[model samples]
Target: MTASPRTPSAAPKTDTTDATDTTEPAAGTGRKPPRRRKRAALLTMAAVVVAAGTSLAVTRPWNTDHDAVQSGPRDTTTKVERTSLSSGMKISGRLSYDAPTDVIAQGQGMITWLPAPGDTINAGGKLYETDGESVVMFTGGRPLWRELAAGVSNGPDVKQLERNLVVLGYAKGLGLTVDEKFTAATATAVKRWQKATGLTQTGRVPLGRVVMLPQRTVRVQEVPGKLGSAAAVNTVVKVSGTALVAIVQPGEDQLSQFGPGRQVTIRLNGGAEIPGKVRSMTPGSGGNGGDEGIQDKPTVTITLADQDAARTAGQSSVTVTLIGTTVDDALVVPVTALLALDGGGYGVEVVTDGTTRLVRVELGLIANAKVQVTGDIREGDTVVIPE
Candidate 1:
């Protein structure tokens, strides 16, 4: 049969050519155009060449060889022998304690003399009472004239302050009250005591606070209240001796890597290191109201595992080291051997064939200036140790 003659539809009528073009595709659109595989291959090859050239251009060494990696300082000294080691932490710490001494009042009152110089009081022993109010709230005990004393301390505040002075190793008599006057000696003692307790060194008792008891040896005999001073009830006194001392409060940073039954080294302020061990770690915060008036810092009390002859309670400072981190057979390197990088951990420059190579390292326990490292370097391999 003959097909009827068909005429093409009139050119699509549209307001805009762009719109008409969007409505339909061109003729021959049913079959895809021939693919230009060779052209694509050429473009891809050109891109790969450009990328490779760019990479070569940016690389530090144009012709990298083993020599480039060998340009660091060579090790003349034998590499430290390898030893068994595990990860641990190290820090600088000051020895401290939360002692069980009788918290004394600065008066010659009854409870002042209860605990003898060598007496071992209970952790919560009731040695003295701060009757009427907390020392932190003392307001010159209702006498406005006391302020005119020019930094003078008196009343219950005087007794409390004086008692603190005695406990701080001040030789002032148990009846030694600073009167309504502030003495130079009194001020000096107060400042020293403040420094030791990590308190502000203002001579006056800030809101009338108690000073920390002296380090082990020094003791507070008594806080002398002014004789016949018309003050609220009799003033209280404190007596603390320097015998049988132990560091009760060791800082959190100190105990971070240490565990129980570890040996400890105690280095007292102006004294030498005395061998000791981790006696026990008391878990609790002193609620001490810290150096600032916020809550007391959370603290751990670590007593001496071994006796420290050089210990002095209430001393200004001491250094402590916990023993658990010690590595008897660990591969240790000088800290100077490692160079700090942007990220955590350190790197060492290994000396090989009169050149240096940087080797990345993972650190283990740290003691003194030496650290344990795990890396490509092996035992007997010499590395540059910075002077």
Candidate 2:
């Protein structure tokens, strides 16, 4: 025989009892009614802690059914204005070069010469001399890792060296083409360059004998190496780009509000404000990379359109305010002008020549305690608020 299906019963309802339960008053002594006690119990439920251990009773202020009061002739009002409304955040940043290049040593010799701080090193210029052999700067995007000579493997480094040689006036009549192959003509040009820089004329370019930098010119910031120190693959000097920039380290949350070409205002240490735009943004893991001094945060680079203004605020801590979410030609009013309508929205009391009427509005961004609104609002329209 088949069994009959059992009917499922409804789940029991749960009652969330209040923390301060209402109780009936005792008879006599003109005690308050249960309604007042229930109301008091509800208000007690909204008690707020004013300090560490003290509590105070609080009441709700948003009442939709409240009566609208009439304003006297002396009541003050605010006029709605049309302007740009924006919301954003401000962060602290440093004004410096846009990723300065650290010059590390690769030659194996004593540091006999070091460039002074604030010196400008250009292409074909001597960065430092090791054991009386000058390590000359060259224009290239690749770092020199191996010796470039005849019989070496063909690669892009050979072409880069050839380009440098051409600019150094060494590849005039050697009939050499700027390519990946290491040719005998390239060796001849190397010999000419060696002779010009007082290096031994070996017709070969040794690793660490030339410093290849991506930029043509670099302004030296500091010489970390002391004269007569052993030259190794260590940071000897720090060089920065000629152009200055403001770098801000923001997290992923703040990065979402940023992009390329956004306008920003930088407040300098000396209380000067300058305008700039977002140049670039690099996402990072906020890694310390074994450096305790540097906070591992994502970086944002900003470049000022006015170069002269940047010169005045060199290498200092500044406050960076990123402007985000801008609405142009917007009708705005004070936030106090908003009132809860009887049904379900917000409205502002529009005051014309001698009459006042509540006009419903569509709200937009709220900035600086002012709200952007639309719908039946015009510039110079007077709006009423609580006196």
TM-score leader: 2
For candidate 1, report its TM-score.
0.37
The Cα error of candidate 1 at residue 166, in Å, is 33
Please write out the lDDT profile of model 1 over residues 1-387, one tens digit for every residue.
001112112232223111111222237665322211111111232243232221111101011111113242333344756775333222344553333333323322223122233333321133333332222211122322222123553454455455445654653443445544456666766666556544566665542243233333333344443333322344443444433333434344444434565556666666666665555555545554545555443343345533345444344455665444345566766655655432122456666776555555555554444567665667777766543
- How many backbone clashes are present in model 2? 1
**Highest lDDT model number:** 2
TM-score of each: 0.37, 0.70
Q: Would you list the C-alpha lDDT of every candidate in the order shown?
A: 0.42, 0.70
RMSD of each predicted structure: 24.3, 12.8
C-alpha positional error of residue 220 in candidate 1 after TM-score superposition, expressed in Å? 4.5
Cα deviation of 259, candidate 1, in Å: 5.5
Which runs in model 2 stand beyond 4 Å of their true positions?
1-89, 267-275, 289-295, 321-331, 340-342, 348-359, 374-387
